[model samples]
Target: MDGKKAKQEIVTGGQFTIPGTEVRKMRSRKGDRVYQIFVSSPLEEPPSSGFPVIYLLDGNSVFGTMAEALRVQSRRPEKTGVVPAVIVGIGYPTDQPFSAVRHCDFTLPLPESELPVHPKGAAWPEHGGAEEFLSFIEEELKPEVERDYRIDTGRQTIFGHSLGGLFVLQVLLTRPELFQTYIAGSPSIHWNKRFIQEEAERFAVRLRDAELDVSVLLAAGEIEKSHKSRIPEHAKVLFSVLSELESKGVRAEYREFEGEGHISVLPVLISRALRFALNPGGPHTSFSSV
Candidate 1:
């Protein structure tokens, strides 16, 4: 191969190989495109001890932090007694992290006034196709993962942050029964004229009879704000919506980090979020891994 081609290939497959974690690739219905999935095993000796899996969007950015946290949490099963489950990080192909495809897959429809042109260039078309993208997860991606992995299909959680967080909210509203838990961190509620607010309210009202046993955790940095403003209103909105849902008997929790900002809250909340989602009965309890 030419030197230029060799350089591209080298950069394409450069994921860190962890001992306990297994990485594999699967092709979607789209013939040539492939998706990489990473899975980690529990630290315990017995193998049949199936685990609850956490699926995180923007896997490239968050998986390492979560996998490490899971490893640490596994050492002391007493604290986390529920077996340490697998975490799946879903991301784009190596060549396409910044491609226009992510916006299409991650975002819901936005009003023309609120739309941001693709960073690639104004000429590049922006996509508003989250519904189909989510269908891919529901029909293709998830079924393959469940078929291959020894995970507890009943206790899965989907986690997303920022734009990804908005998708999490969408899924919870539309397909509330798919997962037992839904977590949104620093969700971008400003999209589509704050459409998520109305969407959430509709879900609460429509699903009044379901009264889901599912848990929803909304968290944001205490300092989340735009440069034009200093106070973070995202957390407040998250709290208000979840609080409203809670009053209706829908399980929910909201938390704020005193000093964290948008870019810094994900890692800080990883452990706290999992513990709360996994163990909701204890209104007062602290998590300290073995």
Candidate 2:
């Protein structure tokens, strides 16, 4: 090929964006670390009240699909009963999942001994900074988002999967009020040898007396790998704990999608999470009203 033709055909992978959507990327400083923050919100103006926002983890992998799903389902809420939302995807400035930094970002503070060990003992990256990431969202990203768009602070939701899913449970246990709704899809509760179970026990104790209101939805694939992964058993334990919360007046639900594994369940997971979190609790809440 001629030099000119070759140059013209060269494709540059720049910032990805879709029409009628805005991308917000920034690096905010905290001590010695400058964390990159990314957000994507619909171009459509929010309702008179404000836009509900869903903060997604692993944005590099799920942001485009989630945002597009939000756009389509919300376009005709009268039919789909899906409400519009500000889709805020929180991810680093990398295309790769499980990057070195996220190893530090999305995990709980635990020693190496707590790490889940396989029969062959697969090595995992360094962990134990999920609290810092939570602060980044609460103290930094939340404020940044509010400054740019009209948002319903009371309707904030956070969704996470896998290790990110572990972070979601941490958020619910440690700071339930940060978001009114929390969704953990195939969360890695087996991490740190079930550290989250201890946290959930504490949370249940607190909920016995606390008047706080929060909604939690935990979804797992019914056919999730059993031989090599703890996802199915871990999810069952979490689901049972969430049922305890549900009985205690906190709105909670769990479902196992048939014939789906960890990754294949997302399409149903994200859309169902929207309905769970965004239910306005009106007479027209269900599809029957459509």
Candidate 3:
């Protein structure tokens, strides 16, 4: 092909957007940071109870994957058991898949003295805004989304990965009633000196005193090497705690994706997370490496 013809062909297309999706920007009341929200609703008519909704973190990265998955799978609900749902992706306004500013929004508050030093002696990014971020989602984002769509309030879900996954756990533990389902993929259980482990333990104690009608899916990659020794162990510990609480109305499962590393596990987890979130009545299996 001629150089001119090839260049023209490559540049012919306009920007691409997922079907049935809308993008909007809203500033958070809890902070000055503005978030780019991506919303995708199924083309089909909603169920009488309204559509279940999934709120995803790292929107720029996984919004298309999850949105398209639902679009295609929900067409064969009888066979796939995947129901149509609204997807809301919470992300920063950026062309990149993930924003460095996520560090501030996804981490829990930690005293400066308790913050861990960087392994290479470099400085860490601003962090510890998870509380405010949660407030923004609950007070601002959820209300706006509800006003725009008919949402099945009882079937709300929250999903996250890495640091975002840590924030998901924070919401589940501190405000278990906020979301009916929580999908945490490759959560940074080791963050802040394994502070989430302590939080899990505390949640377990709380579970003993009160029943929680919630479902959780915790997953990680089989070959994740950063915290190889501790991630799975911590995941299993938390899984065990949740599994024992089945009588208390908690359904939990843990899965390790085979032949995958940290980042590679995301797409695989996205598909499984959809199934788990939409079919909450399915059997809850214990720790398994798939």
Tens digit of per-residue lDDT, candidate 2, span 146-232? 998889998889999877787888888888878888899988877753567788788889888776778888888887856466687
The order of the candidates by lDDT, greatest first, is 3, 2, 1
- As for lDDT, the candidate ahead, 1 or 3, is 3
Error of 2 at 50 (Å): 1.1
Q: Which runs in model 3 stand beyond 4 Å of their true positions? A: 1-11, 117-120, 225-229, 280-290
Model 1 lDDT per residue over 157-241, tens place: 8988877877888888778888888888877665543566677678867766657757787778877754322224754665576
lDDT at residue 90 of model 3 (Cα atoms)? 98
Among these predictions, the greatest TM-score belongs to 3
**Model 3: per-residue Cα lDDT over 106-165, one tens digit each:** 998788777665667887799989988998999999999999998999899999998888
Q: Rate the local accuracy (lDDT) of all candidates.
A: 0.69, 0.76, 0.85
Candidate 1 local lDDT, residue 202: 81
lDDT of candidate 3 at residue 130, scale 0 to 100: 90
Tally clashing residue pairs in candidate 1. 0
